[model samples]
Target: MRKLFVLLISIVVLSACAPVHRFTQLRKLPREYSENYSIEGIKAPRSAAHRKPWIVYSDRVENAAYVNPGGRVKSAEVGLLDTFLVIKTKGDYLRLIKYNPTNIKHNRLTQRKKAEYVGWMHRSRLILSPSSITDVQSGLHDKLLTAITDTTAIMQSATYFTTADSLKVFGDPELQNQTGVVGIHAIIYALKHSVDKRSVLVSKTPSLSADKIGEQVIGWVPAVMLQEIGHQVFTGTAFSRVPTLQKTLKYAPMIYPYHTDSTCSFVSGTLEPVIDKKDNHVFNINGKRISYTRGNQIKQELKRINILFAMEQSSRLPEQYPMLLNAIQNLGPFFAGSGESFSYQFGAAVATPRGMETIPLTADYEILIDRLVKMASYVADTENTPLPAWKAMRSALELIGNTPEAVNLIISVGETGEQQENAPSSIVKTLNEKNCRLLGWQLYASNDDKYNNYVLQLSNMIEHYAEYRTKNKRNMILYADQFCRSNLLREAGPNFLMLDYPYASMTQGGFLFPEKGETLPMELFAGAVDSIVTQIKADHQLLSESIDRAFATVGNGKDRLDSLLIATYHLPQGVKPNK
Candidate 1:
């Protein structure tokens, strides 16, 4: 009898780990509504300003003022600069290098013996501009381009990585290549020339903290960070055209559809309003928002409260939703991006784009690139002047799209091999009506080991199939792995993809979504389209009114990415570059 009990328990335990599947109810929404969300997949972005002319300058020749560039800053600040080369600029700052003098090679800047990098310097004190660049060297353009392309090629080869405090793979020498330094400048060059280039500069190999064995291990900041930036810019570009009442919500960095709320708690990032004795909900922190007129503040706070209410009401687990709603409704209007939920909504709003028409001249694209540069600049300057979130969020709000046709949520498809578009056409239709967009794959996943032969075939097909429609399926198919090996990337097309949540985590062999119906991703997102609508409709009138107004804006339309950038950074008025 005991043995039977053990066997029965084992069966139940294993079954619990499996995914649960349930039928998604189809909503009778307009066909256009559903189609709005059916966004075609885009690949990783390629640079349009490939051969564009650019210039940057430096103030002092001292090498000691250099910073460790790339991925949230992993390397310790090292020695100063002994500058020999000037390749690119981001805003006022100049990225300097020292390559061979004789050949003036552009393909790669062979690292000098002891001349360490002196990172970005202000334009206010530029040592050389466009005209002066010729004085320094006549053929600066070709040399810089070669350096950029070669360095980019080398870094794009990186595939292996570590999060924090892990031992570096010494066998992997590619990560610490001498040419990587050149590539870093190449990135700066590209970024300075065009604010919206989502280049896929993956490292040739995973090399993290080779010099430090015992220190906390994280992935190589340069390549990983560049890729992440690529994702953000691409997201901004794809979302630029989402249907909305106004364009205010369009083209900011795309947010993920789901997030792992810091240990799967029943929390919401949507701020809630606290109830008052008069039975009126005193939305917008009673006296906290003194920054704004109390009435407007109240309206904004109340709107967030409604959003939270919508979230709670949209809960798929029927058993726990009411309590969740009641508990939050009573405790409304806390701080923005705070509460029982996680920190922010960016992660939950993310969706991968396999392809899109990248309009390089658009204001949204310009804003997208500017925000990216600002974020990196802030990271590089964090030691002296840290940009606080409160101030930054306001500035970021300017980037939000104001179009009425923009989408609110994105349904990103899975990797190529998986039936990524398996969410039934009917369900997809319903999603669109509810103001959600989808990012589906260009092709199914490859069965070939690591896509070796398959990649060659696809590349060749694309090479010849450039102008043909029917032959190449779609001219721009998503490269199955957004983090595909450096060699496997497409040479052209609208290369734009986003690495968010489950996808980003999955690529690194970290956390991934559990089986369909049974997992939280399914429970949270499965019926959310209708649920969000249902709950929002029932929210207070004040909430709806505020959201309506926010949908339109004057200056730069504000959105979450802009908010994120604003929250994290603000240029200090007092600080100036060292002369």
Candidate 2:
């Protein structure tokens, strides 16, 4: 009876000891491997409500070497988090070993070769494609995802714990000598095993090999579990019983499993499929036992859950749908703003028999302007509205306006003589009457069939204004930019022209003399007139010289004149020539 009792006792003791032996012998993963492996947790520096505990681990020291290759060497002590495994080495600098659970398995380059190739090809296509703009947009999206994932991985592994606390937990004499993970590792191991009662699981089943079990855990388990374990290890007060923490009187691991289910619902539920009337028989069994159908469902669900969890943790997948939806929502007003700016800068016109015609205040131009005015009126309403497209268009327009060549192109288009007859008579009459305020008149003559005749008419109007309309001939001289000198000479005869030489007088006389009884301030009036004359001279010279230069460079002909006419008519700031 005694022998039998002893035998039973022996069996129980052996059974109790089996798990540790199995764990230690199972593959004997290097400490470095286990230490280096990690998973990203909640973002740091977050609000208390947003903060989450970080969790990381590795199967062997060598596995950890991939993150910090110098075989568990000590790195510089960081002020933020004390002792940590050195995972990266550069020059004399070392960084803590970090791991991203999502990319852990993806570390194999061969497996990702196809994806890498495709990505490279896609980028190349973007650069080489005809529609490079669209390609750039897509590439930006992809790049954003990649950057977010990479950044999240780095952030997750960084320790938030202090060095002093770590040293107290590790109790390594060398730590006092050098800032390193040697002490930190000892503490982590002690906390994990002794305090948390969370021994690394080892396979005892003969059929279930250690590698197979590790694979199962790594592949099938959700990353959130690691986080949970980490949380328990870091915050639990159970480790104070250990010799290292007992002396220091520091808090130990606070192993609470509450709210852990929130991280991974599928795992918490044990991968059980939702029960429905149609699938009820999946659980059916002979009256004695449940069958394997439900088990299969559970297994399948578990597999799916594992994959999704891994993907979520590893890739840092963006809330793409939400971001894109928000971006779209923000683009509406931008487009509206762009439309307004476009109409304002480039006067819209209606198609007419002669050609496309600018609408005077009463026509389609007026309607378009009204729409723009309305949009501008509501600028306060949509002041801060996000509209990337509108912003982009506005930027483009601004760029175009800044370039002299681009400005010239637009002016040429506006001045093209083919569209003159389409303008409102009020506008033409105002110009024909030589009114300085109605400066848009020059743009009308740009498209006329008899451009020279129009020019002659303009000169005649200016001459008439000089001779009869104003006593000092001030208005004609002030608005000299409105008349085409070459055209005037060709039609009205050079002898009939009285050029107001403002600069000649200024240079010849010590000061400009006021005419008798002038009380409106002759100096100010003369100064203004001189300025206008200077601008008119420069503009007329530019127009004639540009025409002459074009003829000299390209050969004198009607084509050169035509080109010059087009060029002059398209001046920026409208055809007023003030600019």
Candidate 3:
């Protein structure tokens, strides 16, 4: 009897120590539907949301996952959260390595830090995609983000950063940073702005890559952020000044997730197909498990380019739908204010003059200006003219900008005393008809079309302003930037600086930089113009901050036009002052 009892005890102990049985497939629970992917190959399956770093919560395991296939269940059971850079998926299983979420909350980790791994978890346990979680912690009311810092959700979106000069993406912000997860409108706007800026990004360098634009632009923009703030200061007292332009971003696109159209190009995922009465698809937000079929699964792409992209590529696999949905529902412009403040308006304005040169003088510019005045009536709200307070503000902003000197940037050519940098005839010819030289730091020039393209941009804005005027409160800001850039350009000579558009976050949008058709939307033109105004005001602040933060990024000591002012000529170092 004693031997039999010992034998039974031994069997029980061994059973407890033996590996837990894991079926080839996980038990059916949430997301019963399944699929597989090639992990080590180029065709590894990943959703758009999963393509980037994402957050998830662990759940009560009905059937536990292992440290290894049959090892003891992992620790940190229910309340634990983590980030997974999912590399592969099969059935309900995801192949991944977990990174420290608790460490990220503490100061030990830099916000951009990744590349660490804990292990894997079942896909069913992902309570949040991170994309669906609001940056707002439920009921707390914070004004989205007035300023981004290291701990803010916006800052958390970045995985890497460098100085502005070291990087510059399309719209010139962080690239592939997974900012969409923040749910802040500005981050969304910035991400979208970065997405389709194919041309502007190309113009950024003779060539660019993930290392250049993505990492550096985010880092550099901050240092130069506050530099453009002075652009907003004017000669008026507080009373003389009307109300400040409402800092709200009126134009950011409303983003939501929904079923992608047949036009959506992603082939790795498919829109959840509707059958009889309901679908098994579900989107879990916070702890609430809701039917995903009812959400904003529809793709909201107003731009034809985006539409074409969706239609051109095959629809994604069912598993990739969430990613595809997030990709289409982009939002936010992010910065409310980003630069330095000045005491006097003119003192600041004169210090920040943008050098402008035209292709050749044209008589038609005056006609456009005349039409511009007529268009000004239409420039404000479609329902009414600008308010008295708005006019007071507008006049104050444009007063110095519309002078003959300001117009001269568009008309006359100032002489550059010295050809600081030599150009090949092709480049010189290109410079003559197209771009201006940025003779700031030491003598430097690139055969970049971005310079000449800027002139065309100015001409386009004036032309569009003359043609359409649908902006309500923002119309004045559009006029102000045009005026500001114009005045700054008057300070330029033929071989002068091209700094405004780039330093300005390339908010320089207007009428299509033409995709295919000659026709363009006045509304899009207006949106682009509004974007320019916002960035111009914002960049000054950003640059001010960056000048200190990202010091010596590109043109570290550049902006001292007063010291260089021997009548628009830049003197080499140690040159004596003009008597």
Candidate 4:
């Protein structure tokens, strides 16, 4: 009797310690669902709100599931308050992962073993809903980042962070360092901006791996290292009216080379994408999730151009020299005030009593006038000297460097000094090489068809403003002169601009000064200068608008870009500058 009793006790102990029998197939859940099934009496939770992939808790006292759909029960029973990950649905049945209620509070998943069970059950037998289940909320708000700094740490948990070696959620995918992530130029929609003391919560969009579990909790990025986007100084001007760089990016591959079509390009190279690294991965921000990828920074471009004045000072027009100098001097304030981004440099083609030569550019308008004034006291006949004018144009191009990307502008003032060298082709080639534009502002001069034709031959683009003309002379014709109007008219592109068009009896528009005498009043010169300055401002504004349009159509196509450039620089037939 004692032996039998001892044997029973040993069997009971052995049975208690034995591993619970579990279906091997039930332990592993499918990542995706098959066909769904619905039946009467198998209803979703009454309080459930969100749609699809609904997670719910067992409301009943007894919840038993089978290894196969509607098959014999093969798992232990669960009770009220237990959690289940709804895997799939069949006729009157549901496949689920029965997990511990405590485990549901964390982003961590309960691996299918011990506390977690996976099986199929009659939908009517168990009840759950989305609203009935609550998830862990980190209680962090989004932050506006100015920049992402080096040493910024990526965290795996919102609660706490471990050593850098283990918490490698992202960074240097090459695994260059302990962190599994690397930083690059990136734009991101942040999920959460910052945590209490340590890191900012960023998105895992930059992840190459589709880590559904690891991707959700992007971990924490060091808060101190993340910079916020700053405000603009001038918000109303055309230069400043653009979307903030952060507002324009979508939640996708965070790291990408700078795109010319990017709205940020509209604002020039002032702002760039921010990349934050925690552990070893690049993260993004702006109240959304950020993804990382390999990309290069946007190239910086030339925003402003250098404006060089190539004014002619002839010995015959003594009184006109000072007037021209005064006019050029006054333009300094107008150019500066026009809000056009440019630097002004002055040079003069002086035909003094001694000889004719081009004066070098000066920083100060007064200094340039002083030097020219001191060069020659005597003024003689307006010699047909185009050498000095040519020299002035060459000097301007040299100052800015004759690169294909050059954007420097040349403004030639005074008499229509036609180049006697007759090398219009060479001039055109040089101008094309530098991508420069020349504005010919002829004041108090006889209408020279030769000079007009010569100016038209220059490459790239040209703007001629013929000021103060006689009754018979053509006052503001674009590239076409009186004699060669038919031939040269065919040569002009859409970019060619002329004021006062088609020889109106008297040149109309604002202050009018006819070529009555050799010398004109300073007041008339000032008006002409004002008219020219206004035109310059209008052109500058048009260029700004073109740039905005070009970027607006970025990613659209190359044809759109070409069209935009053409439309902005060149006007169609019958179209005139806005008066």
lDDT of 4: 0.39
Report the poorest 10 consecutive residues by lDDT, candidate 4: 291-300
Score candidate 3 by TM-score against the native: 0.21
Task: Evaluate residue 493 in candidate 4 and report its C-alpha lDDT on the 0 to 100 scale.
Answer: 20
State the weakest 10-residue window (summed lDDT) of model 1: 306-315
Per-model TM values vs. the true structure: 0.17, 0.15, 0.21, 0.34
Report the error of model 3 at residue 504, Å: 21
Query: Residue by residue across 1-579, what tens digits does model 4's lDDT show?
Result: 999999998887775543322222222222221111122223333322222233443433445667778688566576533556665567766767654445433333434344354677775444332211111232122223323232123212221123211233222112222233323222322332221434433443422121242333233344543454322123323233345653445333234545465332132223332212211212121222211111111011223444565545433356566656666666666544544344344555555544555556554556666776665454444444334445455555555553323244566554444545243445555555554545554445345553443343331233211221221122111112221222112112222233432333122122222252333345644545455445444444443443333222321121111233234335343331111
Tens digit of per-residue lDDT, candidate 3, span 1-579: 999999998887775553221111111111111111111112223434222333333322232334543246663333222333343355655544444445333222333234343344565444322211112223111111112222221122233223312222212233322221111112211111122422111111211122233332221123211111111122433232343432222332223334555422221111121111122222221223222222212111000000001010011112232332233222111211221132111100000011110111222223222332332222222342212111211122223332221111111011111222222233233222221111111111223443233334333333333223212112222122322222112112232223344333222222122222122222332233234444344533433343233222322232222331323233344332111
C-alpha lDDT of all candidate models, in order: 0.26, 0.23, 0.25, 0.39
Best by lDDT: 4
The local lDDT score (0 to 100) that residue 306 gets in candidate 3 is 6
Residues 493-554 of candidate 2 have per-residue lDDT tens digits of 21112234332211000111112222112123223323333333343344333332322232
Clashing residue pairs in all predictions, respectively, total 91, 33, 63, 37
TM-score between model 4 and native: 0.34
What shift in Å separates residue 219 of candidate 2 from its native position after superposition?
34
lDDT (0-100) at residue 450 of candidate 2? Answer: 41
Model 2 score (lDDT) = 0.23
